[model samples]
Target: MEMEKTTDPTSFHGAYRMTPATFDELLALVGPHIVKQTTNFRDPVGVSERLGITLRYLATDMSQRDVARHFCVGRATVCKIIQEVCQAIWEVGAPLFMAKPTTEDWKKIAEEFNNQWNFPHCLGAVDGKHIHIQKPALSGSLYFNYKRTFSTILMGVADAAYRFIYLDVGSYGREHDGSVFAQSTFGKALEDGTLLLPQSPNGDLPYVFVGDEAFPLKPQLMRPYPGKNLSDKKKIFNYRLSRARRVVENAFGIMVSKWRILRQPIIAKPEKVDKIVKAIGVLHNFMREKEGLEVECDVGSESGMTDVQIRLGANMYSGAAWDIRENFANHFSSPQGSLPYQNDIVQRGLNI
Candidate 1:
């Protein structure tokens, strides 16, 4: 059934859950694709109306049935609109917003890391987020993770600016980050030397991503020193790496704050949840890239290291990867790379 034409455009706050300007601008960008025609029984739903429904669905996290009743459309129509809009967003969105960076892009990102965080030889920060969802019927413990809940993973690589460059969603929550990373194409590319990372800015450092210990170590991926026997140098490296990696955490925060859809356990099917996540992630990058820098979302710590992290230790990567980690560790101690606070903090002598 065609959705009843909204008599008056939904208020900036009521319809799309954002300022009218943002809604108009977003509609202008996407409206051409999602517009529908009015039929005889009902006036065709305008693009903004359909777009409003989708945005409201994401912003309010209201049940589809409720959204339908309020908008005078079938619940199925609401679902269809959501799926369609999300798909539309992904098609145009994924490329412009989340497409893999060019070689020059990577160099600029690396330069930012050096200037901003003093972490050299870094490409991006990588991490996995648990997107909670309803358990499938009679699925036993298949979806259950160590957190004792059903979820899927959102593994992503974030540049220095906290925008997602690559993402993989919908993997079972029961999996650990190490396992998830091992299976992902992104991981395989990074491991096999196909990621086309920029060479060491210093001529000695290989571009790498900073991640928590749950991620596997690779010549291209860096995790902090694990176990309690860390040296002062290791502590400095850990602190610096942790700093660069905070961008991912902030990215998740900003995502949750703006797209309240992700704040709760999503009520849709796992497959639908995947599109919703992708759409939301893509929208976030689009907004950041075009709409300007986001004020960090006050979403607290929804992105804290998950049970997946606690359950898995760092992979014992060897050969080039091991040597690479050592080289970075040494680099962090050098005068050219070391931040002033690293030494005092690593020594536990910095006092408030």
Candidate 2:
């Protein structure tokens, strides 16, 4: 019997985090890559079973041994299957789901942020999350973080609809988001002016990615104003930026909420963990397209290395960067750019 016949549609979704039709579509895309040849000694597992096993492993926190038992397979087989299937998922699905955006795509993303989240000249929201993991052999304090956990960082750039546009995984957890970005491939591209970015709608102001206080304020990136402020204008800008930055947070939240494997420490080597993280991110975008699971509003409490500690990360900026931020702050408070509820939200003492 097929997996679908064994359960109802709701139960099927609960197990795989995708509807039956979505699973079939994903299988069609990913099956060819993961299919194995049958040997004369033993028959190969069916492609559907392989995909189902991988999805079950991701959808729940079940250990490999438990998953093996549930599927009536050996624990070693389950381990091998998950890694192979996750790699295939990333290779086959990433292009279709999370392809690199062009300059025009960046403009479209900014337009979506304005229409959906009310932030302008914002290409995307950037943030990082630590994927908890057990300490690696012979590695001490390298993966340890302020949260007192061993982890690998997964930094992502999220569009307004909570889809990941860019992702960098396998950074050590000890490094904060700002330093991680500074060292990331995306950061290097942005610094060297290779990454294609759309011009600002107003021309004078450049398009920027909104991040939390942990990120540096560059001409292309916007972080909130630090410390308690008295001026209502700064408060409005902070609130608006927070509202926009929340999309990345929600992206991470929805990923974790759907794929429970990230709910706890993933017991694997850092390299293996990298494949798993990338597969999860690619699958998230695929689900958004195939399953129509766009997150319209923020979900759960805030995450990432933002304001968790009393002292915020140092804000690295140049004079030009500061001027750009000031221009945005001024625009956010001005009549042309201001939202009617922005002032009220800031005045109501809500968390920005």
Candidate 3:
């Protein structure tokens, strides 16, 4: 009698096609050392297969069970693989992406802020974005935000080039932007003066950051003038500040777009949520460095604003008009020899 043939249960349906170049590129960003290898006796799937499968899931928004089925592994195995990948990315790639700006880097950023958005002595643009995560099995309300949804806060500081200089994640979803900032390490840095403020090139001005109305009005933080029928100059200043402040929004968009895992409601435990966010951030920076992708800036199209508006907008936003007008009587008057107002002007120029 002829023997019947049995199909291999572990055989993958789709052709396994990944080039060394692709693997090398991924490894360069994520680091080869952190990537786990399969061994004998404890025979497991190939490292490439595991990483590729997990990344495919992240990139495609596939369910973990679906990924497991595609890879011919158990659902638990898929989760393990994802955990490993995330941990690897954090450990090996986090440093490569998140770098504190050096003095020269700060100068370059400041100059760009001055030239582009008319904010000066501004080191970085700061913002908070809500990243939706799966409700934790144990503490669901802890992650609920004002939006009445579960999400973790992603606060970031980006330079003129739109690269993240600092990132903090895993704040409770219910917390407001101010609350998150007040409790964060970066906030502490600011409060304690550990995070150095940019020095004015002229030695008489202080540094400042541009923030939305959501942030408090302070010497270091600026908000747009809240009124209609304002003078052309104040309007121009608002426009310029808005333009510079857009960098943080763009950064958030790029991040969520690249890591589709973040796009999905994260289902991981609350304690591990920080790891997931850090991993995504590390990957973002890694891709930037290893892939040499140009950092995109969204300075509104030239067609949108007239040449006069652009020039005036740039100047007004930079506080040049404020610098010139010291009559303190006219609508455009600024306090004479006032360091705070001067710093505000420089800050407006830098577009923080």
Winning candidate number (lDDT): 2
Candidate 1 backbone overlaps, count: 1
**Model 1 whole-model lDDT (C-alpha atoms):** 0.77
Lowest summed lDDT across 10 adjacent residues in model 2 is found at: 302-311
RMSD of every candidate to native, in Å, equals 3.3, 2.4, 10.3
Tens digits of per-residue lDDT, candidate 3, 1-352, equal 1111124322221121123444456655554544445566565655666666656666556788888887778899878877787778777766666766666776787778767655656667777777776777777588776656677777877766667778898777776666676688987787787765556654333465665555544445555665666654555456556766777666666666555666667677765667767776776666556544433312322111111001112112335323322111122233432223434554455442
Query: Model 3 residue 234 lDDT?
Result: 56
Q: Weakest 10 consecutive residues, lDDT, candidate 1?
A: 1-10
Q: Compare candidates 1 and 2 on TM-score and give the better one.
A: 2
Q: Which prediction has more favorable lDDT, 2 or 3?
A: 2
TM-score of each: 0.89, 0.94, 0.73
- Scanning candidate 3 in windows of ten residues, the lowest lDDT window is 303-312
Q: lDDT rank, highest first?
A: 2, 1, 3
Off by over 4 Å in 1: 1-18, 201-203, 294-296, 303-307, 310-313, 349-352
Per-residue accuracy of model 1 over 74-187 as CA lDDT, tens digit each: 898889889988988888779877877777888888888777777876788888888888897776887788788788899988877768888898788888888888798888
The count of residue-pair clashes in candidate 2 stands at 0
